[model samples]
Target: MSTALTFTTSRRPDGAVVLTATGEVDMSNAGAFATALAGARQTAADTPFVVDLTAVEYLDSAGLSVLFPHVEHLHLIANPLLAPVLTIAGLDDVTTISE
Candidate 1:
């Protein structure tokens, strides 16, 4: 069965775009997460794109792959559980991640 995932985008007063994701991020719903990320990027290409993952209960390789290409432009805010995963995946080295 597919996992539940939802994305919400909001513009900050400073003009940055924040994409808040909730629920699990696994192979089952990674495609939708990628689509949301792409859409958020398209919404404000010039501004910073913040992806909030504090509410995400889990994330796997599929979700990490989807985030790889966007590292140059992504500022990730993740919870303690996912911070290590992102770091282990080498995403933290190339991108800014706050835990």
Candidate 2:
């Protein structure tokens, strides 16, 4: 079987969701990214979720596209390379990136 793209999501006792995404999030892994993002959004409705991208090696616009308008808060795990993507997508307003 193909090694599925993976990410870890944890929900705090207070209901905050933290999703740490790793690996490549491209066409091959887009589905997993979408699924994980969707799940995080669903779980974060009450408290908000953070999408940590510190460990992510790559990300496609498709993955970012799916995340738009779906989640309440998206905290990016900061990377100089990827931070610009969010700015280009005009998501800088929607995300909190830690550099």
Candidate 3:
């Protein structure tokens, strides 16, 4: 069974695409996360992709895996709870992470 997850996509005033995720992200729902990211990419191609995970309660490796390909073009906004995990995964090396 998939965990409950919510994804909302919008364009920023500066034309950046923002994908905001709330709830748990794990193996069961990683595919949904990927789909949401893909939609954001399609909507804002060539623009910055910002992922707001401030409302996320949990994120596992499966969730992180889907973000790898877009790391260079991604900007992440997360709460203190997930900041260390992102850093540990080396996502911080490729993307801009704000806590």
Clashes of each: 0, 0, 0
Q: Rank the candidates by TM-score, best first.
A: 1, 3, 2
Give the TM-scores of the predictions, in the order they appear: 0.96, 0.78, 0.96
Where does the lowest 10-residue lDDT sum fall in candidate 2? 69-78
Better of 2 and 3 by lDDT: 3
Cα lDDT over the full model 2: 0.73
Inter-residue clash pairs, candidate 1: none
- Which has the greatest lDDT? 1
lDDT of 1 by residue, 1-99 (tens): 899999999988888999999999999999999999999888978666999999999999999999998888889999999999999999989999998
Give the alpha carbon lDDT tens digit for every residue of 9-63 in model 3: 8888888999999999999999999999888877878777899999998999999
Whole-model Cα lDDT of every candidate shown, in order: 0.94, 0.73, 0.92
Model 1 TM-score (2 dp)? 0.96
Candidate 2 stretches with Cα past 4 Å from truth are 1-4, 12-15
**lDDT (Cα, tens digit) per residue for candidate 2, span 21-83:** 777677777777888888888777755678877777667777777778653467666577887
* True-vs-predicted CA distance for residue 41, candidate 3, Å: 1.1
Ranking the candidates on lDDT from highest down gives: 1, 3, 2
